[model samples]
Target: MKALDYTILTLVIIGAINWGLIGFLQFDLVRVLFGDMSILSRIVYALIGISGLYAISYFGRIGKAME
Candidate 1:
């Protein structure tokens, strides 16, 4: 369970950094590494999307902690 959490956290961080690079430098690291619109890149994009959605739930918990 702990390992899964760490894995998800790592993926989310990677996704965030990739987005940061894209926003700042117009780079697409995943596409550049895996080929544009390739299956592997699409899978990675999907995983990152899912991770982002899952991470949103944590924001509510943080809000609760502050209250």
Candidate 2:
């Protein structure tokens, strides 16, 4: 579980950095590396999305842990 959490968190951070690059510089690292709208790129995007959703549960878990 700890490994899973760390993995998801890392993915989420990567996603955030990618978004930041896209917003500020109009650059897309994933698209650049994988080609625009390619299957591989789509898979990466989906994983990032899933990770983001999984991260939503972290707040609750942290709250409970802090109690």
Candidate 3:
């Protein structure tokens, strides 16, 4: 479970950095490395999206900590 959390967090961070690069420099590291909308790239995108959604659970943890 800890490993899964770490993996998801890593993916989310990667997605965030990629978005930052795109916003700042108009660069897409994922598309450049994986091919624009290729199967692999799509998979990476999907995984990142899922990770982002799953990350919502992290807020629940934060709320608990505030108590």
Best by TM-score: 2
Q: Which stretches of candidate 2 lie over 4 Å from their true place?
A: none
TM-scores for all predictions: 0.80, 0.97, 0.92
- Candidate 2 has what TM-score? 0.97
Query: What ranking of all candidate models by TM-score puts the best one first?
Result: 2, 3, 1
- Candidate 3 lDDT at 29 equals 100
Q: How much does each candidate deviate from the true structure in C-alpha RMSD?
A: 2.1, 0.5, 1.0
Q: What is the lDDT of residue 57 in candidate 2?
A: 97
lDDT for each residue of candidate 1 in 14-50, tens digit (9 for 90 to 100): 9999999999999999989999989999999999888
lDDT of the candidates, in the order given: 0.88, 0.97, 0.97
Q: How much is the lDDT of residue 48 in candidate 3?
A: 99
Q: Residue by residue across 1-67, what tens digits does model 3's lDDT show?
A: 7899899999999999999999999999999999999999999999999999998999998899899
User: How close to the true structure is residue 17 of candidate 2, measured as C-alpha lDDT?
Assistant: 96
For model 1 the TM-score comes to 0.80
Give the per-residue Cα lDDT of candidate 2 at 7.
Answer: 98
Query: Which segments of candidate 1 are over 4 A away from where they belong?
Result: 60-67
